[model samples]
Target: MSPSTPQRPRTSRRTLLTALAATPLLSALGTGTARATAAGDVYASNTDLYTRLPDGEGTDYARRYRRHEMADASTEARFPFHRTTVLAPHGGGIEAGTSELCLAIAGYHPATLERAQADGPVHDYWMFEGIRNADNRELHVTSRHCDDRVALALAAGSLNVLSLHGCTAAQAGAPASRPEAVVVGGRNTDFRRHLHEELRAAGFRTVDGAEVPDLGGDDPDNICNRTLLGKGGQLELTTELRQGMFGSFTRQGRAKSTNDTFRRFTAACRAAITRLEAGPDQAVL
Candidate 1:
């Protein structure tokens, strides 16, 4: 996958939503002039995403934590890098995005939407939503700290459209597309790999590669906050483009309070995990 527009390509949640809400005529605007837009971090290209400190900005907060770093490769779609950041001792643990981790796997992730299309037909988009109540450390076997996401979006795709993640404090009031399924992703490789396995066992499909394809249209569903990331050994989700899911810049205006981070639904997550860990066709709905 060649790099998208040498410059920083943006995919704002607010902008897309605003456009979608404001310009209802795009779908019928055949030229796609209003909608045939392109997204950055396109299906895995050369890119770098870093995590932020919990206390939010400044050197003091910066001193408290560091971004998890590994390697960089904007390779393919299943692994669309959205550039994630976090605060506190939270979002850490060998995870990508949240704690300051780099591309978790080595080299370019070797899956392409085009290749997948060649292998088989690419079709509809499948979205998933979940919450990571535990911190990267807690989930990945570390003993330091924990974190909570009022909401979390996971990556999983079938033919054409890969999953999209509008999950975060930034996306709080932003317009977001609803997902088809929701699966949690943890910090460690083993944990994530295990989770993927469990999801499959529960009858949900996951892409073997890390790429999410772009189904062109007025919507042009490309990956956004597309995949889970690792930072300073911590984990967090990221978007495909810095462009907001809500149209405004990620750090724009007074930050909106994030929705309830999964604390109230601990039982639900545990139950979901248990079900996946335990049975064959337990149903993940």
Candidate 2:
């Protein structure tokens, strides 16, 4: 993985959000622009920057709580490496369901990365790294820590990536009845449509451009859209659906056990990916 970028550090929550909302479009418009730095130890540049730290709370808690050690690939093997990448940026503890989904979808794919806890809990993105995969390459891990490496692997080529993230229904202003909805985003039209269709066919609701215009994945720098090939897909699964998949509401890294919903959902995702790889002539939907 490549080294992290150095730039201006963030001052406050408002400033951080403002930078996030503005940087993508600005990056898309300009060929070469200035980079933004993150506040404190963490450098916020791409898709892996979010946490429970409130406005006033300092990074002390995050610093003291998280253990920043790269995993030993040989001991803690997860998935092999392939051209297709599956990532759970907010895995470990930042987001509850992401790591599980990423691993479930990865199945036997050699190119999958998830943040797993070694000793204690870890929400720090900069510290996350992957074991050496089938390709014998370790992921640079955090975008802030190793943007260049990740860029080369996923963002710089024609690689297809599937990113799983966790979102709240209340945050999206979704109706109570649609708690099992998975909001589809990213620039890959075919993959996005397949995700929506597969999720719906698996008995889950979907919210896309028609319902949530703001989360339409138009931003070029978004981790999902940052694929080297051109575009990729992002799935923001709701808390309810995640809970159904894991059969609990814990913030643990991986599920100790899983439910039928999890199996069905993963199967649907795999089937969609299979069809996607089969080319347009073999598209199931």
Model-by-model lDDT, in order?
0.23, 0.50
Q: Give the winner by TM-score.
A: 2
Candidate 1 lDDT (Cα, 0 to 1): 0.23
Clashes of 2: 11
lDDT for 260 in candidate 1 is 24
The segments of candidate 1 whose C-alpha lies over 4 angstroms from its true place after superposition are 1-38, 42-164, 167-261, 281-285
lDDT (tens digit, per residue) of candidate 2 on 1-285: 233433443446676566556633211101111121232223343333222112212321111111124444686555322335566654434445556666667662112334332331221111122212111011112222334344345444435667665556754447897766777877788888888888789887788844664445556665656665568777767667777776554433236657788878877777667656555432222
Misplaced by over 4 Å in model 2 are 1-8, 12-43, 46-83, 108-148, 155-158, 251-254, 280-285
What TM-score fits each model?
Answer: 0.21, 0.60
